[model samples]
Target: MTDIQFDDRVAIVTGAGSGLGRGYALELARRGAKVVVNDLGGSPSGVGASASAAQRVVQEITDAGGEAVASTDSVATRAGGAAIVQTALDTWGKVDVLISNAGFLRNNRFEDLTDEEIDPIVDVHLKGAFYVGQPAYRAMRAGGYGRILFTGSSSGAFGHAWQANYAASKAGMIGLSNAVAIEGSAYGIQSNVLLPNALSRLEEVMTPGYMEIPAFAEALQSTDFSFADGRMTPEFTVPLAVYLVSEACTATQGIYSSNSGRYSRVRLAEAEGWVSPAGTTPPAVEDIGANFEEISELRDFSLPAHNYDEFTIAAKVARARGIHS
Candidate 1:
């Protein structure tokens, strides 16, 4: 396939002050998308805001001969999110792509984590995506075309130590992306989540012993080791993201993991478990316990579109046995 380009599209990239968001903003701008570079300029812990980080990225984009505008808006608030989207509209006249990449991290053991720690993480990572996306989604619905790329994380989809709050926030993004994909389909808007493993501010908090794992180390090292002095850089993952949030991409409701020149899709599905006869009284706990292996078998599974689809499958099984009651 030819390289994807966004010739006349307008794009919004949050958290673009640094790290992965910066790379995405620059790449999209380079591809001819008029970009709204939205960043709160907050620290990795999500404290203290500055405008320079965002403006610096905008400067880099324009200096590289790409079109972009700076937005120092906090995505954690509804008003801030609206301002971020407004920047794109006021400057470019339309919004075609939204990369919900703004996020912050707080690391603590599950038990040690507090509501205070959890709320801000949720605000920046999960709720922030919703705040920014809701307005952008409506605009896209009106325009009849759009693309949304959500920044999920391996910490949530896979697992990570000392990241209970962060994981919950990241995991919530998957649900958000899934719903957006379904709702935006008729409007020509596609939404997908990315579990990106790249070098960024969050990496500093990662336990060093964890990186000793072979898979972890390999995943951390980009093909060009020089990018991060023998580690991965944010740029390695941004290309795939740009394509996923481009008009050229038709994929939606997908979870993708990208790093070190690798890209793969992640699907959430359920097995077709053993079912009890519908007319029969509710099966005893012993019956369910006895059939645990069959129930948990992964040989055949259905990728349900929603909770109703799974129930629909159960309904089909009940009808098939002529046991509906």
Candidate 2:
């Protein structure tokens, strides 16, 4: 196997001050990619700010014989997003990679969630990706090559309680990533989403007493990268990320999850559903009721890679009805 390297690449890692983002920046730079580390240095709850977090990571990168620059601009605003990308351009002349990892946590029961929690979370996670993604896409398009990664959370897939705001925002990244992947395919720009589960300060917000919980405790038993039970670190997620955003990867529009020291692909599939026996008119209430099992069955499903693929079932229905050739 050829050793993967990024000797001539330039990468922008948002939220690089700490946690998974910090690990990503270090590894990418160690592999020869000149990195622009952007972080708001805000608290996990989305309040307060500092420059030390970002600058510290930059210092670590440089001290390790890697090239890196620090940017303390927020990813939650358009101006900040543009400025973040501009930082990379001004320093390196191009952006060959983007790890859209900037986000803060704000969660509560759906009914108890206030606009304060909802708006900022959405603005930083979903809108933040767009604010930077659009400009980064343009740079990638002009250069005709790029790799973009969106940091989505697995909580979005399996409805965790008290995570209404955070989960929704994370889910939005998948859609944005899919759209970028489709449009970028022709330009040699690949886009993918990551659902990372690593031990980080956000745990202070996500689950205050997680260690005391039996389920959370049992899952983190030093599988490989972990040193003990209930301690799965961010370094474990670095290699997977580095590969996905490298020249060797051809996958795009892909959703992946890394949890409990295991990595897997999560898919968005459409099930083959029961069709109404009668044509043109909608199915009767009783007819629909009779086929609930078939409608909900996942025995036969198709994974649509593009928007137009959704009509496949419709075409099949039309053919069965002899509606057209």
Candidate 3:
């Protein structure tokens, strides 16, 4: 087969100053994309800022003969997000791809996580995607084609201790991407989420003593033995992300996870539930308690594409029960 090239594509990768974002920006530029490298150069806890980080990545791309511009705008606010996209339009005339990859972590146990701690994560990870994604979606709708990717995390989907705030923010991103996928489907725009498990700066800058905690240590130890051998680098996760944001990708509304060379699609599935007879009174609590096994069984489940799909499934169940609207 032929290589997937991004020639003539204009991509906006937020948080492109380092780690996974940097890897993606460089790869896209190398493949002929005109990239906007947006990074606020903030610390892992989302405090402070600088422009040197974004400028350095732009320099790297330019040094390698690739086209790119640097934007030091934060992704935490609406104005910042629009400015990042506007930089792309100002420099390249249009945007074809968006990788919402800018994020930082403030890990703490649920009880200890205050508003000051939780708000920034939500602002950067969840709202940041919204701020950047909406304008990019509009541009893609007008341009007739686009690819969008949001950075999600296994912490939220599966659960991880001492990361309540971070996990909640990441989980919200999955919902945002799903909505974007459904709304943009008719306009040639595809949106998906990436749950990346890689060794990046986010981990390096974790709150002091977080890594030394026994639970965190045990969680790391339980992973496959091979994962310790330098296989979980950010570069390993870049190829899948690049593909998801490429024109060749037809997948939308997908949640994918990448870790130590393992790649798979993560889905939210609903089991076919037990339905009561239509001509009788509503089922009692005892009835539900008795049929709990059947109700919770996952043997036959359907993956609903959107909200309407859930309604369709409910309709099918109602029809089977001899009830019609």
User: How does each model score on TM-score?
Assistant: 0.90, 0.91, 0.93
Worst 10 residues of 1 by lDDT: 222-231
**What does each candidate score in C-alpha RMSD?**
3.9, 3.6, 2.4
Model 1 accuracy (lDDT, Cα): 0.87
Which model is ahead, 2 or 3, in terms of TM-score?
3
Per-residue lDDT of model 2, residues 15-120, tens digit only:
9999999999999999999999999889999898899999999999999999999999988899999999999899999999999998888767678889999999
Candidate 3: 10-residue stretch with minimal lDDT: 204-213
The best candidate by lDDT is 3
Question: Compared to the true structure, candidate 3 yields what TM-score?
Answer: 0.93
Best by TM-score: 3
- How much lDDT does each candidate structure score? 0.87, 0.88, 0.90
Kindly list the per-residue Cα lDDT of model 3 for residues 121-150, writing each as its tens digit.
999999999999989989999998999999
User: What does candidate 1's lDDT look like per residue over 1-325, in tens digits?
Assistant: 7878889999999999999999999999888988999988888888899999999999999899989999998999999999999888888788999999998877776787898889999988888998999999988998999999999988899877678898889999999999999989989999999999887996665556545457756776644555345346887898889989987788999999986767899988888778886655889999999999989998977888877788897776567657654
lDDT of 3: 0.90
